[model samples]
Target: MNQVTNHTECSSLNNAKVAIIGAGVAGSTIALRFAELGINTTLIEKGPSLVNGPPICHLHAGGNLYREISDQQCLTLLQQSIDTVKVYPQCVNVRPTVVALPLTDKGEPQDLLPRLEMLRDKYKALVQQNPSNEVLGDPQHYFRLFERADLERIAQRELPKKALCDEDWLVAFAKQVNFDKLKFPLVLVQEYGLSAFRFAAIVSLAIERLPACTLQTNSRVIDISAKENGAGWQVTTAVNNDDRVNTAHYDYVINACGFKSGELDDMLKAKRQRMVEFKAAYVAHWPQCQGLWPEVVFYGDRGTPQGMAQLTPYPDGYFQLHGMTQAITLFEDGLVASCEQSAQPKLPARFIKKIDHHWPEQLVNDRTIGNIAHIAQFIPDFTQAITAAKPLFGAQQIPGDDPDLRAADVSFHESGYARAEIVKASSALAAADAILEDLLESGLVTSALSKRYLNEHYFPVSLQCQADEVTARAEQLAQERNYPIALANIF
Candidate 1:
């Protein structure tokens, strides 16, 4: 096929051979969609596409999990977000029971009933019904929306409760206002294993639909250039140990490489983007000495300098304590786990330090064999919950590689960063406040996000460890180990 410039020719892209980069959810799904329309599509992934293959560093699945956007125009974005989050379900631990804490005499902890009044008073809701609407509170509020009450009730009876302080022991029993696990769902668990499992499942949902997407592991996209005709783009990737260079051309390219997307923009001389990095870590724990309870328990910190840790269910038969502020061991199998010490879309160094210090000694390498086993052994119920959600099948194979290798390579260079996001008027992210607006219109999103249970109650507690302390301790550790450290926050 020759390079064509006619708008009429390209607009009818059906049956046109399409090339996509990064088989991660976005690229793979796009290829599948094109193939469904009878368009021949080739998906190019720089990593092994198989589920158990080499691990790839990807985006954190937060917005993907709890987003309330449901519009068709917003579906693509929502699907992509959910796909990313689902990849690490076990790690995104969801608490079945959210027990509110009340201060008692002698600094004891009291379990306050989970009430609708608490939701109403703590969370501001501009209830949307038909034509009526209002903005009652902020959107950062955190509330426990239960999806499976009966299951929770059963689990509550079986699980053991963890107290924040040694002085408290009287655990109260009450139902919290939450969505049915069969209906409105809360997926992010703040724990480790289940969160990871869930993330994987969501990614699988999108990948399974693509029958013609090819994933090439250990392939790094080194350069991307546009042709002189402006009809297409060329991407040069370095494959394997041979340093072999393979160039593939595409009529269009979607930049979904997360933090590294800036490099592609530079190579293509296209629009530039900015990304921050953060230092994120997770600590999974199970008691070394198994406790008597068969159910999972959750605890909240009444007085804390930073975010409080949550003790929740994990797979295999143990509990996991993890959060943004503080992480602790709850059961015999508990292990301190760090997902990664650095992340792109970086957080401030001081902020990272604050968060890291919250973990005392349970900081284990997240990918280590021992830590993985401990989580699997202790969190049995969590394991069952995650396994049930993951589909047994895998994605269909990518199409053949025979026809397009002879195409000429295109050359290009970086111009400058895009001052404004240049998107089609119909593009899903065209609006400046696309995320907020979509939720507002959907009725699912409300000022309730800024409520005490959601924001003040949940958000601050999550950030208890603060980024500042984590970095400070990390620096000290590096100094003691005689290892020079970079003081930058990696996202």
Candidate 2:
């Protein structure tokens, strides 16, 4: 294997190894893909667990939240979201989201109709191609409409003790929302919630059981160098509690560090353009609220005083809130871009400290309280809600300068190296497939293995990891992270 630059030189797929750095959503998904094909994979993570980088609450099935992104991006997101659910079905929470436009919003509620109809048609087509793709529900019932008159009828009725249908999900929300402040025909889309804790449980547990994969958490890659005349890569990693470093050889290395991706590029002596943004979501407790409620979004201008406000509900009356305004989620100088000298985006030191460890108690209280107040404007009763705990926060890497870019795929520059830089978690599988394609093109994988993988869509390895384990581990993770146990479960 010495001085082997060409991938074709490898005789056996079992012997050819891959090293992946930073086990976030993208890294974890890519590792799972390679391991399924019987390729030796080593997933190295700087953190103690995989997929722990950021808060992933919403499924973003239709990309309906962003009115700015192109319809093509929305369609791409819809397809990728279906792929994500097929692989990790336990992670999805079967809930609809109520999308509303406040009076202060610049766009009209009618403006959403065209895009919503398009999404419906696209979803129907996908389901027709393969019935399993109907993860969002029947395409005919993908969206439900509500007018001021409909709200009046539901607002006065008693909230259902046990929610069963879309009407039941709307009872609590209809009673709380301010009718005077919104436009006509509120749109309720079939977008769902994703439990990050359960997702982490599935990824970590599945990777451990795979004989071809070795998940090395708390091991940071210190250095990467060419092994003797640029044959392969020598990756040196520092174990968490060890004084000495351990090094390993690999035929290919993929860098999937979410926001710290540029640091890896710098190590490889490659200066590439990218942008990173730091964001967080607040958790609030509202015990007095009645019945199950759908996730709610009140659209407003981003980064302004009246930025968009999102309300997501968990079991046992725990609600997660996100205010796009600077006073809540956005921070001063929180967004940074790579320069010609360095590829790493330099965020404020305090943010880095919070990401490395945890946020200050006072800062957490301030942000969470501010978020409650923001939501209380629309849901007046939400003023009674109190701060839950530390906010779920992290940094995200965007491929280009467009701040609103929601879809990004893999980038391959070096012959033997690939960068899995996906903007959204839904894009994880797409990025992994892109990398797998590169391996096939380079003759690192055989046609037989590809055919074997093709038949196993909605993968079989995932079936071995049971939902009961996901439930227990998710509850444990929520408790250990200082969040309510109910946050880990679906409504």
Candidate 3:
């Protein structure tokens, strides 16, 4: 077992109690930040464990996947992703992502150059501010471009025994992709992967170690009513398989309930606009490959027949695949929104079942096979892949009606109440920081800035050195959660 030392205990400064209802990415990050400051925090989750809401494998270092969004959002994502990498270094799969545009794509390679250059400059500045921020490698080599001819020649080279460089990582992909079907040039960016299981273990460990933070798993918040005389908020919770319900009081309450956040909003008699989207990624095994492959993105129009396709590689020949098409990763009626009836979005029954991780066996196999066939279009050899595990699927909450909203932070619903709406896992830290600022401003948490040093020095580097125990716990979580053990591994 990993031992997280008792951090600061600032309860004496101001015995402020905080209740965060949800242990997903946002809620977990918030709880840790509060615990680090020695604030009394209760992190409640309805699930069997933490961070099981969605499958997050890709770290959007620069919002590269969403070309339609603004450059500001891209910059914000880059900054937030860097912070996340520093916090949970073990969860990051340290490999570059190969981004290719198919011949049918309307976008040209030059369309990416400006943003790439801007991101590179920003990365350089960040690293200059702190040398330790170079988690994605040197800023000068932030991204590499390869022409069709270059890939054609590299494809003829022998497979590498072990990938040592970015070029080495690209060998397997270069050998497989059909250049005839792609545009002239492709680019590789310094993006990484986030193993959801590993992240869960890290956050769970961090929470359990802090004396100020209480992790309540299998506990659901059934009601949230304001306390009499407006002294504080009253939280009613129901534990798993327990006949009795428990009530608690807190100075502040946070609604971080992944897709069910609006339920809390409704309970507080506040209506807000939000949308829920159901998506999935299939797990497949292709043992025929001899070399390691980095994450790959094939861009296309989403929700169409030839939508954006993603291939995420893991150890031992396992790969997680996603296709933005309806028949593959997306489904009809998978997205719904709130009306005047209630604040929660009403997803169809099929999506809700999948969100509960109860997909029919035949449907899982069909989608896995479809994902394999789709990848085979680019890499003809991928047809030999077989389903390895159940699809990682869940519904995500988008703050507003626009599902394209990728950047989000803490929203003050009312006094003594905050709501976090993060569209991507990378935004977790930013959202947490916002709540921390709120705490400081409201005089709820009074830690000397120098005493706390809420910068990069918050988490001790010594704790991160205990990777063996973290990995062990992560693997156990994967098995107990009915996921392939390989999914817990850092690819």
TM-score per candidate, chains pooled? 0.41, 0.95, 0.96
- Pick the winner on lDDT between candidates 1 and 2: 2
Total colliding residue pairs, candidate 3: 0
Q: Which ten residues in a row have the lowest lDDT in candidate 1?
A: 390-399
Question: Which candidate achieves the best TM-score against the true structure?
Answer: 3
Query: Cα deviation of 344 in candidate 3 (Å)?
Result: 0.7
User: Candidate 3: worst 10 consecutive residues by lDDT?
Assistant: 1-10
Which pairs in model 2 have colliding backbones?
Answer: none
Write candidate 3's Cα lDDT for 245-285 as tens digits: 99999988989998898899989988889999988999999
- List the candidate 1 regions with Cα displacement exceeding 4 Å: 1-13, 25-39, 50-195, 198-210, 271-273, 287-305, 308-312, 318-321, 325-491
Worst 10 residues of 2 by lDDT: 2-11
> In lDDT terms, how accurate is model 1?
0.31
- Per-residue error for 237 in candidate 1, Å, reads 1.3
Task: In angstroms, give how far residue 347 of model 1 lies from its true place.
Answer: 9.4
Q: Which pairs of residues collide in candidate 3?
A: none
Q: Write the per-residue lDDT of candidate 1 for residues 427-482, one digit (tens) a residue.
A: 11121122223323433223433121121111111122233443454344334433
TM-score of 3: 0.96
